[model samples]
Target chain A: MTSLMTPKYATVKSAFWGGVREAASVPMLIMGASFLGFGSMIKDINWSISLAIFTTLSTWALPGQIAMAEMAASGAPLLAIVLAVGFINARLLPMSATLLPHVRHPRFPGWAYYGVAMLIAATSWVGTLRRLPDLRQDQKMPFLLGYGLLLYCGSPLFTMAGYWLSGSVPLPVTLALVFINPLYFMLLFLQDLKDPGRILAVLFGAVLGPITFLYSPDWTLVITGLVAGTLAWYLDGVLKARRGTDES
Target chain B: MNPELYNPVWVITLAAAVSYASRGLGVALSGKLNPEGSVVEWITCVTYALMAGMVVRMLALPIGALVHTPDWVRFIAVLVGLLVFFIIRKNVGAGVLAGSLFLMFLMW
Candidate 1:
């Protein structure tokens, strides 16, 4: 997407600044707070603030960072820690593909994509999905640039703050503090759609992951995603066709 | 390792690299992903659903400190949080605080 960002309207300078401006929304705040909680969790586990911020800057993928932080805290072996965190972030592959389609220009160098790839995460991706359709094809990159930068700068600060707080807080408060991250996600999705099939897919995925985890923890999300996503697709297709026929 | 002092650069690096690989893999797999047509929408939906679903489960059936509190109380807090968002006209921060405060209030 960075390649497509033209020198004409969406210059690198403007796009960088655009990313800064867009990050000021409520959703961004939710994401920032949640990451702050995560940062505290990392500090609670005794990870270095500098290293955690480094991960924030370079890794940018929060779930993966948290998984690594938790596993390392548990004294898992280095290789196992890497593998598990990687597995948790397997979803990013599709996310990049989706967002890349909108942002990538034919003339854009591959390396730009690589750099942009560093900033990808759930919060920015969600914002991009909502914002991309409204942007000119040429403008998408700047929008993403702005959005990504917003998150990029905010996350590390939150992590630093979280690291500072995790120790002084009590256990029950700490436990509740943890809930802030995931709960923020739920609220973000609350008004997202009137699409029944999509909503059903979300509901199914939500229920199936944990339930399946009771049997097979590692595979639950993959299994549930395949099952629920497939189900939602067909259900939407059938509904669409039925509506078409009735219109005829 | 004690829960209070370890350098975790290796862990952070592994995670970032892993995340980058996933993002790159998507670019490589784009041709096969098939975002259009019947199956793809469902796939995206399912994938999103799985993500959302896992989150809901985590909150609904939290394994840690949330376990110490009664399930009804936690669920009610979520409900109250959602209610306040509507009651106050869709404020995200308000809803989150309502949810957080409800939990804390129940514990109190």
Candidate 2:
């Protein structure tokens, strides 16, 4: 593995520009379409348009935002809303941690680290991870910041557009827009199937998630994630140990 | 029910803080944490599991307009998506387009 500190093909400026350039295409479309759907959904629920845009600006994670909107609309308590959104977004914790070491540089102040970390979302995290192996340490932070900034800034506009265009757009088209982000994430998971642990985790989680949902809608995500994930991880560990023993 | 309970400003602020707290905590811990440790491994598993759970929920038990379409149609669309994805060497855009168009057609 190349050292994380080495500068290969990117200075901060070039990497930032590179990130901006990369964000101009598919990621932009994905964010736009998803936020549009979110905006429309909020509108459908009769929530404040400003709130919808605020959710886009703050949470930035589609599922959590959607959960908050839905729950709030249903008159779920504020504490419940917070807990639900927090649990839905719990995945970001690990994602941020995983991506941080690659992007953190000593030259950047501690405050810069946290600010950049705030910008880390699924799009930026995945894009950065995929590209990080090829980038210099100096490039990682700027590239991610630039990429995240574009998506962050553009999302609210799309959200507002979708809010206004909610009823105007055909129902099927709006639904398709909503489906895009989930489908993209699913396919991305499928694309990277080499890791047995992750594959098992996905399979187990898929099987258990809805089943658990049938029991408790509010705690479904947290319960399914913990139970299925731990089970899969344990099973994978056992299998690996047995294989190692056999090989030895 | 108090109308203030549903106030957008308060709800959005609280929700945003809660969400940001998770992301921020991860960043705070990252510097001191070893990514390869067992704890990190468990966290990674949980994240993967959470993502998978959310995807499954979206596909099998969607809310809003998606609930209007037949479940089988959505399932078949996903299947066709996987098929196209493999056939085209895992081109996500093409695969997603195929799935989305298929669903739209079925809905129409």
Candidate 3:
């Protein structure tokens, strides 16, 4: 429910800079550490830093990138690797769709949505979902562009660093670096515990996800998402209806 | 023939295309649908569930180096981070840093 045309920032330039400044903080550090870990991962598999950088730029989604690299290293077929990565990255679809409502502005080029969608990784998506509501409609795209571009460019550098410093980084440090991604996500979701439905979704997924993984590792994500999400939605609707009746 | 399928360039190119197609399709689909509608909310719920599942999967049943650490340590570390995060008034960076360090310290 954003207005299609409304001026928020003085110019797209200001909005872009605003995003840049914001990205330079926590989002950048979290992403940098994760990519550093990824870089070292690819290096461990004897892949070149350039290839690591290539995947980082192209895939942008760390999960998909990791799946592709790991699967490729294990001699998985091309189609299998592609499908697995695609499946993992499918979360981006809903994220991008949700964002389009807010980020849409008359001044923003329609075609650029796809390009911006390319940059819609977990970190950016979370940042946008949390922060976009506070922004004016016009500022959304430029701000995202500014924020996304910085992380996008800086990631390859972290990857390269991870690649070069692969062996030197201690095991504990590397593991902790890896842990940062999930820890950040968990804490981020925990902080957003206000909504009952969303809270249920998180709880259901946390419990159901592990159970599904035991049976079907490849499809656990989709299965858990569909089952948990639909259940949460249904229960939330029932709860809302009950509350309304009680009020009456 | 098998090696060709695993070629880094081809693998990355095709994988990237496949991955990006979902995101592009989402944006395109949004133009036809109402953002304020229930469908969008359901999609959002589904997205959240999916993400939470992914994160939990990574934490509870991890791969590679993280597997070396006991599950209790990882879970406890998450609890510590959550506590820090809220106590610090939702400072995400500090929370994450605290959690990571706690994990590191425990492993030490």
Among residues 3 or more apart in sequence or in different chains, the pairs in candidate 3 whose N, CA or C atoms overlap within 3 Å are: none
Per-residue lDDT of A177-216 in model 1, one digit per residue for the tens? 6666666667766766577777878777777867876775
Assess chain B of each prediction and give its TM-score: 0.63, 0.76, 0.74
Q: For residues B25-91, what per-residue lDDT tens digits would candidate 1 score against the true structure?
A: 7776654776554544554576567657556766776543456778787788788888987798777
Q: Among these predicted structures, which one has the highest lDDT?
A: 3
Model 3 docking tier (incorrect/acceptable/medium/high): medium
Better of 1 and 3 by lDDT: 3
Per-candidate DockQ vs. reference:
0.48, 0.55, 0.53
Which candidate number would show the highest TM-score if scored against the true structure? 2
Q: Can you tell me the DockQ of model 2?
A: 0.55
Clashing pairs in 2: none
The sequence of per-residue lDDT tens digits that candidate 2 reaches over residues A1-248 is 44664334536797887888788898888667778778877877777788888888877887778767755655666776676677667767777888888887788987787787778787778866887767877788888888889888898999999888866778887667666656767888888877678889889989887887777665666777788889888888888889999999
Interface RMSD of 2: 3.0
lDDT, candidates in the order shown: 0.69, 0.77, 0.78
Docking class of 2: medium
| TM-score between predicted and true chain B, model 1 | 0.63
